[model samples]
Target chain A: MAGIVEFEKHPADTLKVGKGFSLAKADPDATPGYSGNKADGEALLADLDGKLTALQEMLFAESRFGGRKRILLVLQAMDTAGKGGIVNHVMATMDPQGVQFKAFKAPTEEEKSYDFLWRIEKAVPAAGMVGIFDRSHYEDVLIHKVHNWVTPEELKRRYRAINEFERRQTDAGTTVIKVMLNISKDEQKARLLARLDDPAKHWKYSGGDLKERAFWQDYMDAYQAAFDETSKDHAPWYVVPANKKWYARIAVQQLVLAALSDLRLEWPKAEFDVPIERELVERS
Target chain B: MAGIVEFEKHPADTLKVGKGFSLAKADPDATPGYSGNKADGEALLADLDGKLTALQEMLFAESRFGGRKRILLVLQAMDTAGKGGIVNHVMATMDPQGVQFKAFKAPTEEEKSYDFLWRIEKAVPAAGMVGIFDRSHYEDVLIHKVHNWVTPEELKRRYRAINEFERRQTDAGTTVIKVMLNISKDEQKARLLARLDDPAKHWKYSGGDLKERAFWQDYMDAYQAAFDETSKDHAPWYVVPANKKWYARIAVQQLVLAALSDLRLEWPKAEFDVPIERELVERS
Candidate 1:
C-alpha cells in the first residue's frame, strides 16, 4: 500500500515533471495517490464530485464578486487517451455555466496566418471560470515536433513563446493546470479495437488513429522534449496515469480541488443588508 | 393535433425573418414545430438523441473520408434564455470529439487588437465537424449596436463585414445555423431571481446581466437591424422561441438534423478488401 497520502501534495508533487523528466521512464498505469481497488477509487471520485463542484462554484462566484482568478485545465494525450472522458465525466459535474471547454483542432487557414497562440489566447477562461482545453497549444510543440513541422530553431522559439504565454496567463490570474493523460500503447490498441467491434462506436474509429499509432515513439520523444522545455513553476505539467480511467478522473478532480482550495475562495458577502432584503422579499 | 408539419420547411421558413423583421412582433411562448405539451416535447427531444448522434457520427466520418463540409450552430440569446442548457442538453448528446464548442466572452486585449471577425474566423469548425458558437461574431453587431460601442457608419461597415465573413464560410462548405433565443422580459426577471435565490448558482449571476437588462429595448432594436442586414439565403437566422426550454431544444435538434440530412451523408466505404481484412482478423 502507498503511505498515508497528503491531499495537497501527494499526486501533484509526484506526478509533476521535474528537470530532465522522461516520458519513457514514467509508468502509464501507476496510481500514485490511491492504494485501493477500483471500487474504492470510484467511491473516492464520487466524494470528490461535490468538493469539485463546490470549489468551482466558489471560483465562479468570486469572478463576479470582484475575484479575478480563473482556472484552466489543459488535458493533453494521444488519441483515445480519455481527454473527452475527463471533460465529460469529471468537469461536467461542475455547473456548465462556470466551465469553459475549448477543443482545439488543427489550425485553419486564418489561424495559421497568425502566431499559433492567438486562437488559444482568445479561448482562455474568464475570471472565476474553469477553462478546459481538450487538446491545447501544447499540440504545436508535441505534434509539430514529432513531424518536424517547424525548424529546430523555430521549435526552440515556441518553447520560449509558450513559457512567456503561460506566465502572462498566470499574471492575469488564470491558474493553469496542465495534465498529460499517460496510457500505454497496448492499452490504446485495446480501446481502438473495442471501438471497432462496436458498431455504434464506429464513427469515432478513424484511420488517422492507426496512422498516429504508428508514430508512438516519436510522440513520446516529443512529449519528453516538451516537458523538458516548458514545464515551469507557473504552469507545470502533471502526467496522470490514465490506463485506469477511474484513477485518472479522480486524480484530475483532486488536482483541480487542490488548485481551487489553494485559492481559499469564500462566497462573497451580500452587498445589501440581509434583514432588509428578507423584509423586502416578504413585501414583494 | 396541429396540421401536418414538413420538417424541411416549416420552422426554418416560418421562423426566418423577412426584410423588415420586428423582434416585438415575434412571440416568445410560441412552439412552431412542436404541437404538444412539455412532456411530449421532451419525449421528442429524447427521440432526437439517437438520430442526432447518428447524423453527427456520419458527419465526423465523412470528414475523415475526404468530405470538406461542416456545420456551425451559432446561438445568440438574452441573459437567462438558456443557451448553456441547450449546449448541455442538445450538443452534449453528440460525441464531444466531433464538436468544437466556443463561448465568446467580451473581447480581450489581444482579441481587441484584431478586426471583429478575426478571432471568429480563427474558430470556424473544421471539415465534417459540428462547431457551436455560444455567442459569436453577431455580438459585434448586437451588443455593440445596442450600446453604441460603434458609430452608425461603423456598425453599417460591421454588418457588411459580417455578411461577407459568413458568405466566405458558406462558400467554404460551412452550413451556418444562426439562432436567436427569444425570451420575454418577465422570463428574464424570473430566471435572474432564481439564480439570486440559489447559493450554488450565485456564481453564474453577474451584475452585467442586470446592467444589460436596463437596455432591453435597445438590444431588441439592434437584433432587428442586424437580422435584417445579415440574414441571407445561405445562412438565414432563425428566431427560436426559448421560453419553453424543451421545445427550444427539440426545435434546434430538428434544425441540426435537417442540416445534416441535407448533406446526404453516407457511411464511408472501407478502403481495404473486407474479405481479406476479415481473414486477417480471424487469424489474429
Candidate 2:
C-alpha cells in the first residue's frame, strides 16, 4: 500500500477547496505508494511511439491487411480517482487516428432499453481501430451491485459473462485491457472537494455525486469481487493505484505495449517493379 | 504551394511493397507543389501535446459551468489522403472523457433507409463534448455527386441543409470545424501502388478502388464544388495539403487549438469547506 502513492508526484499546494467538496492527497509515506517509476514511463512512452510508427509503416505497406488493429481500453473508477489524468498521459504519445474514445454516462432512456452492454458493444473497435471506454459494462457490477439493483446470483453471472466476452475478443485478435483505477476513500473525498472549489473543474461535480460517495465501501467490495471473478489469462485486470496519476498511466501504457507486442508486427517490404528513376528536386 | 511542401520530406523511400500491391512515390516538387509550410507545421506539432493537455483542463473546467459547448470536427478526403493521420494528431492530446470519435463507412441497409444526415446527427457531440467524424455527410457530396446516386438538384439541396444544420449547432453554442485533406492525384496513385506491394496491406486495398481512381478529374470537380458550396463562416472548411503527414498533422492541431482557444475556458473553483489534512506517509 505504501508504494501506491510514492511513485507519482502531486504538488503539495495544488489542492483546491470550495463550498462543499475537499480535494484528497495521497499520504506519500504510506506503505503502498506510487512506485511505477516516471523515468521508466517517459522512456516507455517514447518507445510506444516508435513502435506504433513502425507498426503503421508495416500496416501501411500491406495496404490490404484489412484496417488498423483497434485496441479498446476500459478504465473504471470512483470519483476523483485520476481517470482523467491517466487518459491524458497514456495517450500522450499515441497517434490520434489509432485511438477512439468514449465515456459512458448514466444510460439515456433509449440506452437503458437495450441490454447494459449494447451501447458499449457498438463502441467496440472495427478491424483496425482502438476504442477506449472510460466507464464500461463493469458499471453493472459496480453500481448495480452496490445499490442492490441485482441479486448476488445475477451479479455472479455478469462476472462470468464479462470473462467470456473478453476471451472471445482476445481470440479474435482484439486486445481488451481493463484497468480499475483504485484510490483511497480519503483521497477520493479530497479530490471531490477540490473539484467543487476550482471553477474550471466545477462542471465535473454534481450534488448527487455525494450520494455515491456515501457507498464507498460498497463499491470497493463490488470491485474486489469483480476482479476476483474476471481476472482471466486472456483478459487480465491490472489493479492500478490511482493515488498517483503517473504510475497509473505508466502501468496502463505498459499493459498496452505488452499486449500489442504480441502481434509480432513488421514493416512490409516495398516492391519497386517499374524500375525506379530517382530525381532530386531542390527547394530554393 | 511552396509553403505547403517546403519542409515536407517525401518518404517515398519508406514505402514498402508487399505481395499483392506496389508502392510508388509522389513528386512533391512537381507542378502545383504542395501548399503547406513545414516550419509552421513543426512548431504546431511540437506544441500539440501540451496544448491538448491545457485544452482538456479548460474543458473539464468549462463543464462545471452551466452552459454547454460542443465541438464537431468533420473530416472529408479521398482514400489514402491522410485522413487517419490528421485525426490521430489533432485529437491526440484531449481528455478522453470530453472527446468522442466515429468513423462512418458505407451506410448499412438500416442506415440507408433514413435521410443521409440522420445517422450523422446521431453522432453529434452532446454539450461539452468534442465529436470527430472520419468521413461525414460530405460523402453525399463527394461520392454521390461523382456516382450520380443523387441528382445535381439533390446535391445542391444538401449543401443548404448541411449549412443550416451546422448553423443550428453553432447557435446552440457548438463550435463546428470542417477539414478537407487535399492530396493530389499523383499522391493517390503512389498510395494505391504501395498497397499492392505489401501482403499485410492487401486487406485495405480493393480492385474497385482503382475504378474510382480512373475518374480522378470528376472526383476533383465534385470535391471542389462541395467545398465552394458548403464552406461557411459557421463551419468553414480548411483545405489541408496532405502530401506531408507531419505538416498535415500540425495544420489540423493548429486549427483545433485556434477553435478551442476561441472558447475562453477557465478552470472552475472548488466549493468545499473544512480542510481535510492528510500526512505524507513517504517522500521521494
For candidate 2, the per-residue lDDT at A280 reads 10
Query: Candidate 1 residues A186-231, lDDT tens each?
Result: 8887787776666556656666777677789999999998999989
Number of the predicted model whose DockQ against the real structure is largest: 2
Instruction: Point out where model 1 deviates above 4 Å.
Output: A1-61, A64-68, A92-174, A192-237, A267-284, B1-26, B30-54, B92-124, B135-168, B195-233, B270-284
Q: Output per-candidate TM-scores for chain A, rounded to 2 decimals.
A: 0.96, 0.77
DockQ, every prediction: 0.12, 0.23
- lDDT, each prediction: 0.83, 0.65
For model 2, residues A1-284, the per-residue Cα lDDT tens digits are: 12222224321111111122211232322313334456655554555566655554443333334434546778888887877776676654455555566778889999989877778778786665566788899998899999999988988888887887777677776777777776787677677667655555655666566778778878877876777677666666656666766556656665666556666665443333322311110100
Alpha-carbon runs more than 4 Å astray in model 2: A1-37, A52-72, A92-100, A110-115, A118-120, A160-175, A189-198, A206-214, A264-284, B1-40, B60-65, B187-209, B244-246, B268-284
Q: On a 0 to 100 scale, what is the lDDT of residue A137 in model 2?
A: 90
lDDT of 1 by residue, B34-91 (tens): 5677777676677668889888878888887789899999999999998987887788
